[model samples]
Target: MFSASRGFVPLLAAAALTGVLLGACQPQGAEAPPAATAGGPVRILSAKGLNPQAGEASPQGRLLIGRGKDYTPLNEDPKALFDKLEGSMAERRKTGWAIVEALLEPQKLTLDGKTYDVPLWHTWYEGMSANPEVDQKIKLFIAQLAACKADADCHKSRAEIAHEVMAQSGTDKNLVRSLVSANLTQVLKQSEGFDRGNPEDELGQGFTLFSPSFVEHVLAQAQGIETCSNKIPWNQAPPSAGQFSPCVEEFPRSAVMVKTNWDQIDGASPKVSAHATDAAAVTAVLKGGTWPKPTLEPVDPSGIYTVQTTDGKLFGLKSIHISTKDTREWIWITLWWSPKPDEDFGQDRPASLARFNGGVWSHYKMCVTTAFNETDPKPWGSYETAQPALAAAIKASYDGAVEQRNPAPYDKVTTWCSNPNLEHHTGNGRTNCIGCHQYSLTWNELKERPAYFSDTYAASMAAEYPQYGRARRRANFPAEFAWSFGMEFQEQIKTAREDQGFSW
Candidate 1:
């Protein structure tokens, strides 16, 4: 069974969604965005209207406005960054759906001298290592600091200032020693295991992508500590009397993060099922310690999106979790490939999606929750709406939470969400997206940073375990609900200890 830590993307086996094209996905017969020169500025044509920087509302009353590139000020005033997600449940779903379509547009990447047109979301800069240029700059700084490690005479130098900052913060002594004992390569690769899927499932490979704004905020904070600590300026508790920390930072409202799961199809090819592989198959794939590059051909009749890497390996997208900081609480959405997509989760998918990329998106079923629980006034899907599938899915999610309680005193509530490919094992399947991620926090000890507590996946755990529920979450929003950041912090600790020849 899978543990609470891991989560994944897929095309839908369901029927196509129907609705008006909201300028997120392409309109009828619209072509994918033209490929840009590799290493050049992204043209971003298809995402123009969806740009939250425009600060406008759509015809459906959805707030399209969101914080964008100029979001640095948002760090000082976190609440101002939140734009309430206004509109009915169906309208809100359209907003989320539009966001998904906008991200799915083709983005070209040059890997190993070959151009691959992957989804825009796939092109986000990998966070494990800073870009080469940035890495070089950091290395130079680290080298300078290492040179002045024990020299009392170098106190007035820039390197000394950096060392002093970290030393005063308490966590830096271990970090500096760890960097000195190990080569730079080890430190950069330390956080790479974040997307290793569940160690329990060998065929699974997951990737988490961060929006440029999100990365920028992280870098800005890192720069504050001389690029040594990945710490965000957060407090131990929520703000008092509606006042937020002037220095407390968070991912901007425009910050959109995605986690995608990939399947290793090797010889399975056309016979591959539109579902998760069994554990036996996973064990077979990981018989050795090495993770083989996935290889597989498309299922002949189904038009699911598959990727062939420069290494001659083939991989298929299995599931996707998209989250945005549009609202203060953020919007949670998950999409998975379903063999029977049009049923259950796919029943109310919009029809207009057929126009985008030749209906490639129609093969994916999606569900989204803007609030923690079902706050909709109507009887779930009782009202006539353009996106009944979204409404019903959300309702079903809350209902599932209610059922999980089994009796009375179900005071705590949340909408359930899980990806079949990503959150498949044990406690994961019954998890709520936000409910699990809300625990993305770390200890506030300024001296020695500790390891991260595991995340939760069981639905209604909040009601059963109030100590770690929303109240605890509200009091401790350490990583601002971005587990990757917290993981990065902890991985550094691991790298430090390992480099010092200490093994757990």
Candidate 2:
């Protein structure tokens, strides 16, 4: 969910973010040391990074600031800086770092100078149904069909047998059909409505794509979650449909899903709204298209959008959520996207790939949070290509590397994370992507916590957040105000004073 000025509003940002009351929370003590800045303009070095104590020959020791007198430390408080990665995003856009293009693009990674290509998601990922325990469920479901078609039961139609399984497991019939025909091509085809081979079919705009980390979080959590469809209020919906994910008989967790803001006037339905319902007042101000700011164009007749470069666009504003297998953490994600520029930066329509540095658009930008709960103050905010030159200058000063030039001809390559939310945020202070997600959790289960996840994959670049149980986990604090993951993790530690007793 995002709140910014210029008449921007998400359809139901809070719908998925707000809800619940687990218990009181306390921020981590400053005594604890800083962890990975996660993903941002900063770098995560093995030892003292950049200008540890500030570089230079001054008696003041190291020159802490890389840019001018005022700048953020590129190598400290990784959790916080991981919140902003301007240059990296530009780099990521070119490399497919965790965007949907990752699936469509040919990927390569240089490790120690030897390049290794990444595997395709359809081949690399297996849904929970592939797990031994889950496989048993599938097998049992199959046996039901075999019995229905047995010699004596030849009178039973295949549809009859199919219905039996659906009726018995309370699953979606279409899902059953999909399982029976599941495979790489089929999965990819079902995931989106566009044609992969046709340039015209391109999403036409930057859209959100789920990363493998978010997928890992969902499947891992499926291990503990059960069908909420069978629960009290959830049961009122329909079979195979639950209040939470794992509610359906099974979800194709490995199937990477991406979506566009169809509510916009430029989307599939040009007549429909493309923003949050609660903020119609904001949309009224932008009746005339915005210039300088990224402009929006419809990708499909269905209302999906493709906006300008990462400068100022929320390509795919989506999130995914799931409880941890231990029921102690809530793995959720916040996703953003930038419309890849036309090959020639929109100088001409249908720009030739050969004329551009890369065959596709010039760049894309995105950010995400680690699988953290309520306690994480800094969810990973990675990428802003526009400010890369500045970031690189700072990095060069600290790392003592030569000033890097754009290997490609495009200029957006030098951008930095702009923190879209900050544009409309009331203050001038730089806000990270996690700023909004931080409110995505609460106490007492009085309401529901939204599940945030990604939608696409990058061909090469991937902005990765630490996994569950990693030492680099973000901190918790400001008791009484908890995050989804923190609240979930410490749920069992509740005490009378609304303090202490947390199982940790």
lDDT leader:
1
For model 2, residues 1-504, the per-residue Cα lDDT tens digits are 111111211111111001100111111221111221212221111111111122223211221111101111123243333333222323223222233333323223222222222222211212322111222223343454345445573676533443343334222111111111111112221123433343422122212222333332322332122112112232132232221222222222232323222122223433311211111211221221111122343332111212111111122221111111111111122222224322111112222221111121222223222222212221112211534332332232212101111122211112111122112211111112232222222121222332121110111111111110111112321111112223221221122112321111
lDDT per residue as tens, model 1, 1-504 = 111111111111000110112234332233333333334432221221222222223322211111112211223233432322322555555666776766665433232233323345544433443222122223333444445555676655543443343233221011111111111123222124444455644333444556655654554344322222324333344555432222235556767766656553445445333542222322222222122333333542224544432122334455678887766667778887655566556666676655443354667777676655544544256323744544454555445454444333334454444555555433444555665565554432323353333234323344423322222233445455666655553444344334444332
Worst 10 residues of 1 by lDDT: 172-181
Q: Which runs of model 2 end up more than 4 angstroms from their true locations?
A: 1-101, 106-260, 263-431, 438-440, 444-504
TM-score of 1: 0.56
Model 2, poorest ten-residue lDDT window? 13-22
TM-score of each: 0.56, 0.26
Q: After the best TM-score superposition of candidate 1, give how far the Cα of residue 462 lies from its true spot, in angstroms.
A: 5.8
